[model samples]
Target: MYYVNQNQINKRLEFLNWLVETIPESLENKPESDKAILFLAQERILHLALESVTDIGSYIIDGFLMRDASSYEDIIEILHGEKVFPSHLLETLLGLVKMRKKLVQEYFHLDRNEIYPLLHELPTTLSEFSNSISNYLKHELNT
Candidate 1:
């Protein structure tokens, strides 16, 4: 039997919830002079949010004895295989996984223009991710 750590999952979900709530406000209404600082800050937040997502997914996979994930992309793939989220979300989640890699490995070379558009989608994507995990957990636990 797989042992799901409800508390651990919920804690991560709470953090994800915080990240989703923080993204929109962080992206908007910034002073022109502060653009550089804002970009860096947003970059860090997005990185953290993406990290939290993978962390939560990994936790659930381990708890449920799902197939081992060989990479960050695999983590999303495994969750998708289990129907944790809809098919439409699979590509977006995979893109975020790739973005996480870019944030970590290519930080210095990142283009603000390229990243800025994605930031606009962060809140909605993160919210969808969090909700999917929460719903999956609720169903698994109750079953």
Candidate 2:
């Protein structure tokens, strides 16, 4: 049997919940005068949400003695392999992981046109991710 840190996972989930709720408002209320600030805010929100997903995945992988993840992509692959989330989301999650990398590494050069569509889609993706994690935890840990 493996140990899972339910409390830690729960805390991350709670934060994700907040991010999910905030995404719609943030995207909807982007002011013409504050476009730069709104862009940064959107980027930060995406970064935080992606980070939380990886953090939670790391926690579960570590707790369950899953093979070591060599990269963020590996973390998502492992979770998918374990059936923690649906197969349909595998590609989307991988894309998000890549976006996370770009957000961190190439923040100065990101094209707003490219990112705007993603910002619009993020809330649904995050909601699905959060639900998957919750369900996986409940089923695996009997919580």
Candidate 3:
């Protein structure tokens, strides 16, 4: 059971929103030389976890890669393991897609259909989810 504090939730949301604006910029400005290093680090971590872990590997992979998932159902099953991922991780993933949906579409010149699967109206969804999770945490943690 996770005990998510209100203060933590607020802080995490703030951090997530800030990162929402920064990540695309980071990827855009990432230097040619550092791109390889960045990918190497990512691959290194993926291989390490795949080699060593049982229950949590897919969670890490899905969160980081965001694709290459075998199936949506498999991802959901992994996410429902004894250790639920921190709620903000889910929120951030959804929130990032939500926040950048338009920008990505414009930048890539993609049509609505192309970006549809990549984004959701998570600003609305996240608010509801945040409240619900907060309520659950309050009840479960008695905090």
Candidate 4:
């Protein structure tokens, strides 16, 4: 059997993550809607992670911690491939963020310039998120 090293795996994960973050975010206003779309995209990435890697490090797959290759792969395929998130999850996330924005706004607040950091970091953050999932997949798959 062939074995993969962690460094090579890390590099691949990094590349995959970079690919994810570069996806366009051209939808209008609706911060919550944007966040919802981003979240769904992240979820889709996670599905790939599970399918692509072994995930021995207890990576959370759809809220459940997955330990084995089979469970991870199953969850990943179910989630990542072929339009998994559908419309419902997007609706739910958008609704929650929209309805609760007042409450969320009260506790977690950001100023105009302060928010800039997140905006500037958006690409990198999404990239890191993808990398994390890719790493999880690589570790689990041991390929």
Candidate 5:
């Protein structure tokens, strides 16, 4: 039996949704670069979104899966092992983890173009994550 932290998961999902709502229709329309404040806001939002992703994984692995995963990829893999996450998301989540590392450690002089598409689709990815968790739990509860 798994003991899930639905509240925390939902809260993280909510925040991600909020961030998504704040994003403009297209990043392509912006100037080659953003103004100082715009850059700051985008960076902050990315940081929080990435942080929430890790936190959600931690909550599940620690609270329900009861496993200690040493790294971000490991966390995802462990959850996958438990049939909690689909295999298709493995590549994207791993990429997100790498991007998070880059954002945290090498954010200075980073290229926005590379990150633009990821930012654009972040909401959908996050929503998929939330839905995956909800569906997994529902299936477990039913079984």
Candidate 6:
């Protein structure tokens, strides 16, 4: 039998939702116009969102699935290995892991252009993540 820490997962979901709301829908004209503040804000928010993603993955795998994941990318792999995340999301999640690394390891000379696509997809990506987790939990609980 499998179970989840629903409360913990909900908190992560709430934080992810907040990040999605904070990020801009489009950065076409905004990044340049605002320059310093907006760019830094966008970068930080995107970094936080990626953090939230990994945290959520870790929460699920460790707390609920009772599995140990070695690294940020391994979190997603562990979830996938347990059939929590669908096949389609694997690629994007890996990309997110790399982005998280960029934000953390590559501290200096950050580029907004590279992070833009992830920000743009934050809303939908998070929605999919939330739904997938919810659906999995629901199935596990019911069975």
TM-score of every prediction relative to native: 0.92, 0.92, 0.31, 0.30, 0.79, 0.84
Please provide, for model 2 over 1-143, each residue's C-alpha lDDT reduced to its tens digit, 9 standing for 90 to 100: 98888889889989988898888776776559988888888888878877998999999899889999999899999999999888887876786677876799999888767667776777777788889999988888786
lDDT of 1 by residue, 1-143 (tens): 67888788889889989878878877787789988888888888878877888898899899999999999999999999999887777877787778876788898888778677777877777788888888898898885
> lDDT for each of the candidates?
0.83, 0.84, 0.38, 0.39, 0.72, 0.76
| Off by more than 4 A, model 3 | 1-9, 15-112, 116-120
RMSD of each: 1.4, 1.4, 11.9, 13.4, 2.7, 2.3
> Candidate 1, which ten residues in sequence have the lowest lDDT sum?
111-120
List residue ranges in candidate 5 displaced over 4 A. 25-28, 31-36
Maximum-lDDT candidate: 2
Superior candidate under lDDT, 2 versus 6? 2
Instruction: State model 1's lDDT.
Output: 0.83
Which segments of candidate 2 are over 4 A away from where they belong?
A: none
lDDT of 5 at 132: 85
Instruction: State the lDDT of candidate 5 residue by residue for 37-141, as single tens digits.
Output: 566666666777777778888887876755799987777778778877777776666666667766888889777666666677666766777678778767866
Model 5 earns a TM-score of 0.79
Q: After superposition, how far is residue 21 of candidate 2 from its true place, in Å?
A: 0.7
* lDDT for predicted candidate 3 compared with the true structure: 0.38
Clashing pairs in 4: 53-137, 53-138, 53-141, 54-140, 54-141, 55-140
Q: What is candidate 6's lDDT per residue for 22-122, written digit by digit as tens?
A: 67643546646677766777778777777878887877776575578888888888888888868887887777777876787785877778877777766
What TM-score does candidate 2 reach?
Answer: 0.92
Provide the global lDDT of candidate 5 against the true structure: 0.72
